[model samples]
Target: MRSKRIVILTEGHTNPITAKTAWAVLRYRGGDVVALFDTTQAGKTAGELMNVGGDIPIIGSLDEVAEPDALLIGIAPMGGKLPTEWKSIIVSAIERGMTIISGLHDFLSNDKDLVAAAEQHGVELVDIRKNNERDVSNRLDLREDCLRIHTVGHDCSIGKMVTSVELTNELKRQGQDAKFVATGQTGIMIEGDGCPVDCVVSDFVNGSIEKQILANQHHDILVIEGQASLAHPRYSAVTAGLLHGCLPHGMILVFEAGRKTVSGMPHIPLTPLPKLIQAYENLAALHMPSKVIGLAMNGRLLTPEQAEDERKRVQDETGLVVCDVFRDGSEPLAAAVMNLRAEIFGTPVAS
Candidate 1:
């Protein structure tokens, strides 16, 4: 039978017993072990791991251990003291889908992004600071922890727009006060290197748009949208910005269906006038909201006809002012923001 791969890490010599004990448990379970010894302690710590069956595959550095199945990082006082390079090491693990068991103090201070990324992938975060002193076995079952996420949308989808409107109307039908956020061409995607793509560009534009939205900050829920390609390079930038900005408090990722392949998945096309508005409404609901009221629309679609429909729908459903970019005669996006009630900011398209 093939053995499972398990990785163990210790801060310094004080926790050699803890390190050896943790390693022994895994080895007893028929698992292969790779241990990373933090030798930051004058050289005494490095000598200890070598002392006890010491020839264990000692990783001189965190970078040395690129990939591991499960990582047991001991947050010793000495071990917790780290250089910046350690940040990348943990991020790389999260990217590769590793189960990381870390203490609360270790997680909150050192690897915050790693913790978020891990939670994003549904990894369990164990706070061992207080529980480490207790029997690991007895405390494993008590996983009562508070984790909350404030997700915000910076893109749009067709169905999402309609859904936002529908949701708003439904809320009003229930006699609840509602608020929403809507803007034109407010989506972006920024690359790891700061380049722009469809979703990325949309996200970038929306970052500023979000700031503008925050100025008003009157909505209970917010959603944004994009067209054709959902995983367009731009999507990454926008997603990162929204996650970092922590606005709107929810998110909805929208892509066109039957239009193009994004990240190897079929997306719904965001063309036509009406569905574009619907997409805007739908993307509005992707994040958690305040007051838990209704929904709003945000995206770069909405033609003149779509804008008219959206405005009418906004009036009927939300009973609040609604607007679109299509009637503005701006760069044609299958919809113009021109209308008697709405304002346009760019050059008019020659019909």
Candidate 2:
């Protein structure tokens, strides 16, 4: 019988640890492991492949690697910090229509171009961050958690607070093992002191940084909260690519008063401005595909004029399917995002 093949896209050294680990795991699970590298100076590369021995095959680049059941990406302990080194291997794999699992840490910085390249090729980006969710001390409060958890910059909001919390709880309940960390006003919780967890969270701080950590570490899922959509559209898409291993199913735009919505690209909603002025160049505002639809949620308080203008701005900028929340019913923002994906891809929304 043919062995199930799994490809590991990584630099030279650190791959051995993973290569051997994967070989053992796959064998136990009834599969195989394959290693591919463009170049490796670090002694780690040879050691790992050798450690895994004959079972795991080592290849040169994405082009040389055969199709596998899945692709696993990681940073080589001895690998250079730059993500670009692994670009050819990553892009080539995705272009060939292979399933991918990536390390978020290096992926965001080193493989950024490859990330974009992967999306263009319609490859699904999977986050290994959840594997580390348990790494977070449950005893540690949110504030200290944020300190330990590195963040990028701070600008933008994550969206509705109630919705964000609920989603966090749901992820936990589902045993998806994702970490729900925050920034901005609602940033991580510290001690018994009170902090504005409701302020528009910053994606630069939490979402990007956390996702990278989760991916680099190879965790399954990592949930970054307080990131507002439209704030940093590219980073948002990048985050989506890092975490979910694909472009965000779609983007969400929300309006809620006194709520201080966190905004970024992808899942995060933008700031709550009365008039969300939008214009379009050749590309979508957030580098989203033309196929993604834009939707509006009234938050049940917008005037007719306000709603009309919001609708117009979204329609003009995205050229996507737009739906009014008031008309669409009060589905939670996360659920709404799933619904939009279903409508576009013709797949049933995973309830």
Candidate 3:
């Protein structure tokens, strides 16, 4: 999948928040992304819109791109439903012999028109969110030698996946045997394989994530991507399941610096960072002892000064290393994880 020449369809929504799939793929797998299809933002490079995806052109239509191997749905909205207006674009891509890839909860395989069109064109429709695993959690013991680091969030879509990926990459850069265990659609896409834990049945959520952890336990470190916040009104169940499933040794708390309300739910105010930190720690303590080792701030909405100030405030209040992994790089957060690992397991940090 990483080798395929892919064009992302972001259409009208092409910002970092809305078009996170496009942004993340470009950030981690830019070589595979040939172009992005966003008519509203056509004629501009993705780098021009977001700070990532250097020089990748944004095309208005499929005809503007030449011989792409796949078309990825690049936006993940609240309900994860496919926009009605994008059907024609997807059909057109299928007609042109490009495989369709989606992460929406509304499965493309269930759509009659898409299925018929794909059959006619002899192209595949890959739904990253589709899961068939029926395994239930058995409280299986995990590998003692491997260190599991999980990312927990204050609200949904606050950069847990980004923080996990960046930390894993940084650990690898430092010569540690680290593996990223992806738990969501974006992370799965970036890693090429992972269970969309959020999509699995409630009974199988823990088992689903445990399967991935066990599979990757050969590595010395497992940086697991997280899902919705435990404080989230609608999606907290998945968070609790993940917390119990992975049983992380340490966690990095992620939050958008100035975000006060739950995303897409303005009426529900976001839980404070300290309370969220406590809640996650308390929840994890039920199954295994785990601590919040650090904080990863999503400061995209804040200016440089404001971001820095918030980082300091968070650090001062929480007494943990705080970093915006994208802006400050993952070295500090990685170092914190390594320190925690060394403290808990007496593991030697690589020079």
Among these predictions, the greatest lDDT belongs to 3
- How well is each residue in 94-176 modelled by candidate 2, as lDDT tens digits? 77767666434333323477568667877666533212221221221222111111111122321233233344455456553
lDDT of 2: 0.38
Looking at model 3, report the run of 10 residues with the lowest lDDT sum: 136-145
Give lDDT tens digits, candidate 1, residues 50-145. Answer: 333343455545455545666555432322343355556555556666665543233433457766887787665433332111111111221111
Off by over 4 Å in 1: 1-3, 11-32, 37-50, 61-67, 75-88, 103-112, 119-123, 128-351
Worst 10 residues of 1 by lDDT: 186-195
CA RMSD, predictions in order: 21.9, 20.9, 1.3
Worst 10 residues of 2 by lDDT: 144-153
| Model 1 vs truth, CA RMSD | 21.9
Model 2: runs farther than 4 Å from truth?
1-4, 14-30, 35-48, 63-65, 74-82, 107-112, 130-351
Local accuracy by lDDT, each model: 0.36, 0.38, 0.91
Ranking by TM-score: 3, 2, 1
